[model samples]
Target chain A: MIDVIHPSLLLFLGAAIVPLLRGRAQQAWMLLLPAAIIAVVFSLPHGSSGAMNLFGMDLLILRIDALSMVFTSVFAIITFVGALYALHVKDTTQHVAALTYAGSALGVVLAGDLITLYVFWELMVFTSVWLIWCRRNPVSMAAGFRYLIVHALGGVILLAGIILHVMDTGSVAFTAIDPDSAGFYLILIGFMINAAVPPLHAWLTDAYPESTITGAIFLASLTTKTAVYTLIRGFPGTELLVVLGVIMALYGVVYAVLANDIRRLLAYHIISQVGYMVAGVGMGTIMALNGSASHAFTHILYKAVLFMGAGAVIHMTGKAKLTELGGIYRYMPITFLLYMVGGLSISAFPLFSGFVSKTMVVEAAALDGRAWVWLLLSLASAGTFLHTGLKLPWFTFFGQDSGLRPKEAPLNMLLAMGIAAFLCIFIGVFPGWLYAIMPAPVEYNAYSTGHVLWELQLLLFTGLGFFFLLKHVGGEAKISVDTDWLYRWLLPKFALGVQRVVDRVWDAVLGGLMRRLTWLVSSLTHHHGPQGILARTWPTGSMVLWVAVMLAASLLLYYL
Target chain B: MDLGRLLEYLVENARVLRWFAYVVMAGLVVADILIPSAYDRFPWESIGGFGAFYGFISCVLIIVISKALGYLLLYRGEDYYDD
Candidate 1:
């Protein structure tokens, strides 16, 4: 065993003290802590170490494989970026909460056992909520509470699955699982909720957009990435995910098309992009899984870029709805350009990072001879192009010129987006840098002529479709329908109905109970005459009458 | 020319245009099967042709019907949650 602990965890745990110190120390917590933690995480002991026994099976927590390495690197990068984004805030509660959250995610990646993983997993839920509530608005507080309920439910489900899985196979090892048991299925569902899978996707858009600006940036970076990590560990290669993946791909596109809030639109597309990863895992090929990891890594980068662009707009304009905001791109050109690369990357445009990685999943599907899935993927591709690829930037940055002049985003924000933008194109132009670091050996070429041609044709044709239907699809109105409409709308409606029934029942029962008590008391204390027994003194006539009545009863009994 | 005749004249016969467009769509779909792809493989898939055509048609039909009903049943106003 190594002595004095792994350096990353040491630095990360060490940084927890920074926020606790006095004034200047708080700022130091934001700046230096991330720098120190990243350095330490980058220096972890490489390769898979021996698995430690947890529950019953050997657990590999410190596996520095290609798969885990990409996420660990980006996870650390986001902490720094999210810190820079949130540095303006003075709230120590949010600062410490955010740092601990970033540290928890780091620990999860380095964890070797299921118990260790679960420990970090639950820590993530509690800390992330404080970041949201830092906005200190009634709506935000409510949204934070709603987010907590859902996350708590996810934690409970995951805990049950982990416990049952351990008991069943006598193994708490994290690896690919067969979907043959209640435990396995519950765990998949749990991960999918964090993944923002269907009917439950609303919490993401509902909460993230409502949090304080810096709070949103931190909220965007970590939660989904951690969920993607757990999914990669637990449910790689399961067939049912193919169906869920396809549904998410299309669902994101359709809802995104209708969404008016800029961040919510991006949030929907987050689910859409994760579909590529989920489908990749379902394909179960090594290439596909690698592609998923690559996609997740790139997605976090570009998505952060997108959210920052959005945050910049909200920073300046104080508006996020499409109707109220436009033409601000003229004011913030640097931010606009940075955001464009992110958008293009997510759309899987040729030579962008998305094109290089997403194809592997598609190729794996074809290799597996699942033609229907291929068609669904193509349709989702068309939708992605229609909604996010062409629609997001075209309308926001280059649309009917809303003529609203907002100042450029702050220096650090622009710098962060620029860094992400450079990576988007860098990985697109030279995918080898990423390919070199994939979880598996790289043997695939994303530059094939057929592949390039088909993608261009698909994206171009979808763009053509968008122009044709812009009239039907265009409007400033925010459409409030998604998996979220269920919890946000339907759940409350159902609760109101149940409450009405309960109120009526309770009122009737209590009313009857009050009446019966009154009736019983009245009967017990009745007085027959004007002079009651206790009100007047006892007279001689009354005593004599009582004795005469007794004598008469005795004589009557003797005669009988 | 009268208004109807003027419209027809500018469009080159309305019925003729509709029929022409329909014919062209059918032609492209038919050409897909007859023309040899560069790989010498006809991309015409035979995996339950109804699944490609009529299954989709039925699914669309059901959705349209269900959505029409849900529109009336599940409608909520703008301020439902705000208050």
Candidate 2:
């Protein structure tokens, strides 16, 4: 008996039905579906459900706990807002893809077994790629292909790890295990890929900015956070994540500093922000884990706001590069304001969402006596302000006038950004509300005078440096080469060269052989024809003469 | 209702804003020492404006170092991959 319906199933059904509807019905369906999913998520009680025997194995398809619930609730909320932001889109493919992509992420979070999680993990990849493809540009097409290939590789790695894990443990239940085995290491690598840790991160920065305006918002929020969720669930105490997470934290900021495109800059910052959560998970303390969870929840809301604001600018002006945009505040005042909220939240400004959540992670590091980790993370925070908090807005909105007079974003986009912006401030002011839902109890305080003053000094000094080097720090109209350079350029050219050589070899070998065979057949047929010497009536006469000659020779041999 | 005008007013007064920012920076530096800090793992946390100095130096170093690295190796034309 089905006691509780899966939240993801509701989204999947909604996605299926969306394509059949048209115009107003589709729009209403898009809005109402996420709302219904949210309602269902809230109504359902926490426990394991959807368990059954399949092929002599137990499959727990749905698992709800504090960890999964936080992700589900945030996923549902983002879908609703993303739907509202995308209501102006006329393409039904985008609507379906968005809903299904979000649904698959929910499925992943709720999955109680490794096999079930893998199914949803692959679905997340397949569905999310369409958001990039729906842009229907050469860049988007290539990026989407790259995005798909990378995620497919990640999925394979994860599947291999799961198989080995199930074999060794004799169970498929997803639980935390010591990272002392090949299976767990493979699993960690797989999750790290999705988390966009440093060398494996180029796909995210390459693909996200190229997605359709609204699609980028969904792309930013779901995939990496789900990986963080899985990591926390399965490998919380793995110390390697701490090292990689710190590298990612600093690495993302540096790349973002070099980025010229506003959306791409935000995309790089996603790596940096997720790095904080990863570092928290690596710390493996209850406080750090809770911090990672709360940070993910808050990051989703604020990052969505940032993307919405940037998407609004791109949508209205048809400009994305920072060089092409300047003095946009003259036209997009509300967007500028909303984008600032996101910036402050990400920069960990006092009275912002990031300030409330990010501090916990830093405090965890401090409490754990990992002074170097804490220091690096704090430095990365300053860099985050340097690029995302200051550089992005200063260049795009407040820099020299490019003399562009684009109008404000559409009302729906504004409403979406506004909702996200409100949450950034709300969560900042009322920490207990967000803290109450965390997996661990709230013992850390974000509002102590020491924490607030220290945070403010860090942010303000960063801002001070921004103005001092404003001329040099602004982005240029240049692209920063990343690891994607290997596949995007080197490999393709190498493959083409190999293909040319193969074609020549095939022509030489196969063509020459075919010609010889054809010639041989023609020559034989010509020689054996009725008009030819061998095919004439001399065949029977020759046979009798040959027989007589053979008999005479046999008689001579017998006489000898 | 014309938010553009208000924003323009704020933005055009760049000199005033700069001064205001300087004041805030100085005040935070002083407050850092005056306020009784709840937790201090590093000895530098007790120093006045140490955080401010750290933040400023870190931001500048990040930009400068990244910009240097970008120019030396990473920077490429917009179609660097396409070619």
Candidate 3:
């Protein structure tokens, strides 16, 4: 016995006890599990553990390395923050689903074998979808189903890939996969789907905005970040990811400009932000990988803050669309301030957490002499600020007054947001704490005079442009047709059309058969009736005459 | 001080804040000329105020292009998928 306990196990077992307790005890339990998991994750030794042989395959349930540690730490922290944010909720089901979802994500980060990873990967999907359905609305129900179907398909593809890879290599270890391996593209596609790579991404924007307010916080923090971790772990330096990542970075920003729902806009930004991590993994340089890991850690905190702020507004006002929100900053100033911290951090302002981490990836691109990648990424950064930093806040908080005066968010929500806000600033100011835990030693400086000046010029000028185009950038009361339009509209319509054709063919064929069968039945009935010729009384006399004739004919033939 | 009231004050002084923004922008452009980067991998980085010009142009183009794309193909009524 190695005397090690998986952080996921702590959360899983802790969740089992949630229903048995009530009131403050339950809340304390909810908070305590994540706190304890954080401690356990920090204390984990840097090696594989919980090894077992199952069905002739070696399974490592826990793998602790610098890479895994970064993800597990952030996952644990967000679980706690999310718990605090949801403390006031009376529903036990959401609580259980959330804890297990977080744990499953941790299990994914810590998994050391393909089997273990796949098991946790599917568990993540099943557990997280409940967060959407728990909203208890028709839209959420439909969105949850779509979300489930897409992820289930992705999971099947992943399993196929894992099976093929294991068969080809005769190993199940979850390590760097060969690009030429049979399972390579399948597994990458699976991870990319979860990472919200385009054409497979609409499930996120469609479902996440419809999730329960508290649920969106965890939903935002966990699923895609876990996928990023897997990408970093399994498929580093794949050139395809580089192209896909740049597309994702710009793609999300483009959609964000068209989004009306506040959470939906943030959801689009998630795709954009994850693109950075994906690109960093593609770069495969030490600095780039570290940037991906660190960016994920910071992103979880700040993104949670943003969601929390948006959720608070929704919780209080019962409105989620940006067009319907504004001027409540006067009532919920703390929420506004905290949200701006997140917005600024995401925009990579100097002395913010995003500044330190996001720049590393861009710097890596610069160092790699990929001028186009660097420029495109820089352009995306400006767009990030334009939407998340400027447009979102201006519309939601400070734009035309909607005259709705909702109370400040609940105390627990404020405390959760406050903690995340503090961390965003704390990490921004002293990135040394964050950098120390990177998989590679840090050599980048984020606050150099040149860098700060350049970023300021970029961001401030973007703000200038936003002000210039303020009237046009305001949220419109319309939805953007993303790739989900295929499944939601086109696919369903096509299926209906196919069903109509099948119905018409069946009706024509069955109708003809029914008519023929009716005619045959009538003719048989006419012949078999009691009044027919074969049943007449004279039949016996005719039968005798025919028999005599036949006897005579037979006698003649025999004589001949 | 109540943060809300402070924000209200800032909003009331929007003109002054706008000037402040302009001042900061001007200052950053000036600083771009004086403080050269330790490492300039790209030739454009050597140009003074390139960051400002690019940032402004990028922001404007992002807005215009995205909105145009939205109106032309992406944007639909809220009940797009309902039927």
Candidate 4:
């Protein structure tokens, strides 16, 4: 039998073309496509099967094993939720862009070789930026530009690494890359940028808040998490990641603590949560990698729910800043509850999805004999609750009444959040479905009595920590500093300096050229009679004599 | 404001107040006890290397203290960036 092509590709691609159709057809396709893709993603032969060679150098596409399957399944789920969430959106450009964007990420999951991976990788960057640009505002356009510059830098580094990898190895395998050369590190940096690794993470918080309401939700889901998948794939065993991961974790904690914007706070926690995953990847154990991969999988679910809730608030009241929003739960109770689940899940509260997945990464960190990383990871974990879990929902939904009476989110939006909320609880309650599909053996249980008890104790103590440090958490606004300032602010300033130097050189060159032209014209005018020989009126007598002399000379030469 | 009230406010609002300060002093005392000397002609790199976290925490605490000091001493208005 012909290999069952993953239905997601067909459905998304088909929906993409629907934008070209009539209005009724477009809306119909938008509704149908996500469901079709989700069904097809689950209906596949339930095992790894796809090609990995196209041009004799292995065009590696479609490897659907447990590791990738877990990610792909959640990706499909989010794409569905995101699509439903966008059902009321009239912007077909965004709809088409979102489809192609989601499809490219699926292609990445199925991609089994370096070439195919890069192809999907670049497209994910290319198509997703349109969602940002879809906001159709100058602010959004600028945000998209910055977002592209950073991701393009990542893409360039990634491409360079892949080229060197292919040249050195004579094969384009998409497997755990050894530290044979700096190529792996280049590849790691490339992936790390998208993973929101610090010194490179500002593009996320800076641009994500600027995306259109639904656009941010879609923007948040795919690109960074896909890079996380790549890191898990390529740099799993590398030890250096442990240090970088801890820095990222701490950076997220400190910044989230100081952030005043709600979306920015969530954005910071993205880095914080990914820290645990990167540390897990560094640990290199099967359990740890599985944890990282599984956490990456569950993270997208909860994060998308959080974004959806945030998007709903922004949609209803047109407010995203924490200072502008408060007491919205009075109107949007469903979204508020949805957001609470998301917050709890992300904080890793016991019986939520994060509790099951995040603990895996922390356990892996503790097991790796890195006490400092474990301590920081624990602090970051507590900080997650303080910033995102308590701070986000409390500020946006339940804080002092600002008396902004917006309506509840639309039905489609609620449907999306409801589905995501269900998954969050369902996964926490019954992780067997997720565990069975892990890339590694899944003997480590998330729900041991001791594990649950300690997690509660940890969270309870951290709750005390947050309330104790409430003054610190809610202190006067200061930009919690991080390494991203280097690129976002400092590098741009450096670029401005370089640009000034280049502009001076250009001006001097042009000045010289213009002066040289003036000099040449003046010299010609001085040498020639009346004016420059190049553009002058010759005397009639001289012209006639010259023509006559030329004729005479020609005749004389011919005679000779 | 009176001098005592000003000092109390500064101490209460100091970013690195108390906890990190105690840690820093404890660290210095530990170093003093361990080495028994103010300066070594050739100190082991391991000591400094191993002491990086304690030192980093100390520095971070100092910055925090500096911020509170800035508020106390250099309490600029909040509209600094506006103009």
- Measured over all alpha carbons after superposition, the RMSD of each candidate to the real structure, in angstroms, is 8.9, 4.9, 3.8, 11.0
Supply every candidate's count of residue pairs whose N, Cα or C atoms clash at under 3 angstroms: 2, 0, 0, 1
How accurate locally is residue A78 in candidate 1, as Cα lDDT from 0 to 100? 80
Q: What TM-score goes with each of the models?
A: 0.82, 0.92, 0.95, 0.79
lDDT of each: 0.71, 0.91, 0.92, 0.75
Report how far off residue A474 is in candidate 2 (Å): 1.9
- Native contacts present in candidate 2, fraction: 0.82
lDDT of 2 by residue, A315-373 (tens): 98888988888888989999999999999999999889999999999999998999899
lDDT of 1 by residue, A475-509 (tens): 34534555556777779999999999999999999
Clashes by residue pair, model 4: A62-A110
On a 0 to 100 scale, what is the lDDT of residue A210 in model 1?
76
Candidate number of the best TM-score: 3
Model 1 chain A: worst 10 consecutive residues (lDDT sum): A1-10
Report residue A497 deviation for candidate 3 (angstroms): 0.3
Give the range of the ten consecutive residues with the poorest summed lDDT in model 3 chain A. A528-537
- Tens-place lDDT digits, model 4, residues B1-83: 14334444644575766556456545544553454332232232124222333333432432344345545543333333223
Query: What DockQ does each listed candidate score?
Result: 0.04, 0.80, 0.82, 0.03
Clashing residue pairs in candidate 2 are: none
**Candidate 4: tens digits of C-alpha lDDT, residues A347-417:** 78778999888888877765566667765776677667766777677678766676898988999999999
In angstroms, the error of model 2 at A112 is 0.7
TM-score of 2: 0.92
